[model samples]
Target: MRYLSLDNQRDGFILAARVLMMVLFVLFGWQKLAGFAGTVGYMASVGAPLPTLSAIIAVVVELGFGFLIAIGFFTRPVAIIFAVYTVATALIGHRYWALTGMDQYMAMINFYKNVSIAGGLLLLAVTGPGRYSVDGK
Candidate 1:
């Protein structure tokens, strides 16, 4: 069977995918900043060291780097960093093994979601942002 090709719209496809992938980070990061105290409290509850600092870093990575990814600036490096960050967050925040019942199920779902997002980021890193990006590659 023949498969449809997106070669003609590759750049547009990349831009759309990048924007979609980063939108969650941008929104969540903004939320974290808007509710700084609440975010810090949650981080502390999760046993994160220097919760305030962690929150700040998370905001930067999510908002700043996420924007960069969306705009296709430094696409490869940003994708790689975001991929690692996604996995790290999943492992740190979604410890399904440490929970039970519904909480465990929820955490497991989120963990896998994060992992899947990371996989997409990794693919973006390899393929790049395409010709319409700042990298123009």
Candidate 2:
């Protein structure tokens, strides 16, 4: 078996990573928008200050920034912002330690998942979007 050269694989690898990273944001953002009132209610239940405003911000950051990152436009700053947002959301929304039983287990899983995603975004910030991206051009 032969491995592709790093130079040859870099752009494709970056594109794949970017796509994967953006999918969750895009889908969830769309869901939030599609069920705007429900999302606002959910945010309020989670103790988010100004639930409507929080919902809007979540939509913008998730959908807007997610799209920008997917296209590789302003990749570094976007990824960094997203990384911060991911950590914040995980802490605020996934308070696993405060929960019990299955809820605790689920929240813990989500918290760790968010952390992992944030790690990926940080990597993208450092490595950039590569040659296939708008930022690259």
Candidate 3:
């Protein structure tokens, strides 16, 4: 009975997790869209190759893939892509070794956070979007 209850709650929990995780990406993507030039500048500052294009990709990935995940469309593949993107951003944008002291500390923190998010995304890829999603588990 209890086990069945937990199983029944699975989809709801997955939905909640999907929404919560995607919120950050969507919000960040919106920020990038709102400040396109600034996002390009920041990408350049982070030494991202093809800064303008990279910024555009970031916005698209964060918003497009983020939305897809939130709505549970093509969830598995998108989660995998999002995980890779997250890790790539961690490596490219958060090169803590290049900085010193607090700056380095902060960058390292952000880098690990990105990595953590990526891990969660991979888990989502494995677990799938559940019955609440368009993918229908």
* Candidate number of the best lDDT: 3
Query: How many pairs collide in each candidate, listed in order?
Result: 0, 0, 0
Using all chains and alpha carbons, the TM-scores for the candidates as numbered come to: 0.94, 0.95, 0.94
lDDT, candidate 1, equals 0.92
- Model 1: clashing residue pairs? none
lDDT of 1 by residue, 1-137 (tens): 54998889988999899999999999999999999999999989888779999899899999999999988999999899889989989988999999999999999999999999999999999999988788885
After superposition, candidate 1 runs with Cα above 4 Å error? none
Candidate 3 lDDT by residue in tens digits, 19-119 = 99999999999999999999999999889999999999999999989999999999999999999999999999999999999999999999999999999
Better of 1 and 2 by lDDT: 2
Query: Which of the predicted structures, 1 or 3, would earn the higher lDDT when compared with the native?
Result: 3
Q: Candidate 3: how large is its RMSD?
A: 2.2
Ranking by TM-score: 2, 1, 3
Error of 3 at 107 (Å): 0.7
